[model samples]
Target: MFIRKLWAYLLGYLILVIKGEHPERLINLAYTRGVHLWDLCWIDAGTLTAKVYASSFRTLRHIAKKAGCRLRIRRKRGLPFLLFRLRRRRMLLVGAVVFCLILYCLSSFIWTVEVSGTRRISQQKVKELAAEAGLRPGSIRFQVQRDEVVDHLLRELPEIAYAEVNVGPRSRIRISEKQLPEPGVGYCHIVAEKEGVIESVLTLAGQPLVREGDVVRKGQVLISGEISPAPPGQDEQQGEQLPPRQEPRFVQARGIVHARVWYRFYGEAALEEIQERLTGRKTLIFRIKVPGKEVIVYGPREVPYQFCRLRTHRYKLQRWRNISLPVEFVTIEAEEVRHQHVRRSYEEAVEMAAERARERADRGLPREAVTVRRRYKVLGGDEDPVRVVLTVETRESIGVIRKFRPENQTDKTGGKEGV
Candidate 1:
């Protein structure tokens, strides 16, 4: 079927070339034969001219003989036959050349990675494993063992739970991590560290021996892990005034304690405060790998945005974090957000200042303390350096030291049992 189609196309090209070079005789023959010929065009390197069709190449030959025009025919070069009636066929010939050029251009670079999602696992390490698995840049995507490659990569890093390897115009490997087991050694009970009215309490690790509504003073135990005195035995006697024959052993328990602490904060913030503005903002992105050079995913360019003030927070690699390569980069994106008015009333401003002062007091005061009252005075005006005065009161238990030693603590072992 292919060969027949090839021959048919060649015959059409030959007939077209013959009629293109001679038109007068072909026209005359067509008039006499009372037969029709379809419209045909003659194309060459520099010209695209139309021609009157002819029934046969022989009829076209007879006309060309009278005109003294040379008849030249040749098989076209390149696959899919480039047959030409004339000696030259350069215009159509360039198609094959252009197709080859496009093929070359597409093969020169890596287009994209097919798989992603390597969080705890490194992308570069996966790529390296892919390279070892025979999947890398310039490698034909179809020839690689994708599943086998993924299995191999996972085997190299036991830390990876599951891996998926994909091969497309580019190759990519995605990895998931297995959760690490928690370290379970031992724990201590956290008691009411500084006693007060039990405004609120939480049991993070051990049991709670006190409730929110209960009242407890300094040095008062809130939670107890130590076992209560054993029930009196047959020979044992127990009473408020009676003493035991044997000494009791001392036990220790440890834990955390938090209370409903209160505080008062004071500051004056004006409605017409001056702040820096940004005209254009810039953001960037980059990637780096161990044993590999840092790569910029998107390169840098001139930022069109303006910035009046800027603040930044940063995170450093923790001791347990095992990042091998140090990849550092910064990004900026252009934005038009600018500083504008954020207005409030004088009473509102004083209220905000008073609330801030309260927060500060809460952080510094004992947890048992509860906010009770707040007092404030407008110290100044908006035009004249504005000032605000504030006072906060809270209810809480105060500490009282009942015993002291040479070290400020006397062991109570000498006290009579049950006394």
Candidate 2:
């Protein structure tokens, strides 16, 4: 504290000492007092500038009068560099302090949190869990470990099948939650809704139709719903009718089958975004706060944008976080965004659409299937968005079955042929 005060005082008034060419006679007269030497000059053929330290100006005058030399003393001037810096000292200091405050605030406050991919689990519940894990508004971002928080949430909530946490720039935290699997109503059969070549086959349940190296078309069965007779002749005798059974007879069965199947899919997406840049216009102000009191730093002023955003910055010791300094600064930034519709390249758009098609197919198909071959091509134009045709081949063979009863057969005949 003492050093700071001393520096402040010295800084207010700088010091410089200058001397001239003179020796013995000037030293002797120094003992006397009360003589003024505000204006004195010394003439030296070789050098004029010298160094000297005296307790009073009187002594300097005495020494000048005794010697045949001249002396002059006054505050130094003509230093425009020093003066300019001195004039802006307060501003520089305040700006530096405000910058540090902003950094501290960023480390302590949670700016953003995102929740995704949860249909069964409520977003509110996810937020609640995050808040409980120290991720609420104004929560300290520096003190929180995103991965650790996610793990904790997953452990605490059984409904969350998967969970993830992301920490972004400017103290933003994002949370991702996945819900647990619900009980299946019954065995869901994934048949060849559409068709393609069977590159591979994986049987999870029921009988398989086409094997690894087989080609199939639309409506072609990769897995059969019908059961083979115990033996070729073991089948019960029945009246043969004209036109063999065209409809597939469903038998009671449960299992999963994976066969490589290929189908076409399409997708379309728009690419456009807006950005902002300052046009050489900026303003700043300062504010102070007392106990339970508030006031504006500078007078109210209109900003550039219709929507204004205000950010508050504060300062406190790292170790003692509760004790905040009285000084505070708030910055308000107005941003204007212009909308633009950017269209992707024909090739790029086609590729994107094809990828989307493959993803959609995966969603529609059984999970047991694995993708093998994919082919995509553009078929249409811009404005309407280029048409992307995608053929994706995946391996999946799933089927459903139902048991046939004698009652069902009798009902088909209307009881006319029943005994």
Best by lDDT: 2
Off by over 4 Å in 1: 1-263, 276-284, 287-295, 308-337, 341-367, 380-384, 400-403, 406-419
lDDT of candidate model 1 versus the reference = 0.50
TM-score of 2: 0.29
Q: For residues 232-339, could you state the per-residue lDDT of candidate 2 as single tens digits?
A: 233246754434343334332344333456566777644432434444444443345556875667745555454333444554334457775555445544444444
Residue-pair clashes, model 1: 34
Per-residue error (Å), model 2, residue 250: 11
lDDT of 1 by residue, 1-419 (tens): 68754544554433234333445455566456553334344455322222322235466566556654544543222322334432276765687688889887776544665547666667777777777887878776667887878778756875554677667666566676543222231222234435445554433333456677676655665544332444544534543444343533223332333344333445565655655456555454333333356454564444334542323333333445665435444343344457777666776666666666556666765443446766666665664234555565565433221221112224453222221
TM-score of each: 0.28, 0.29
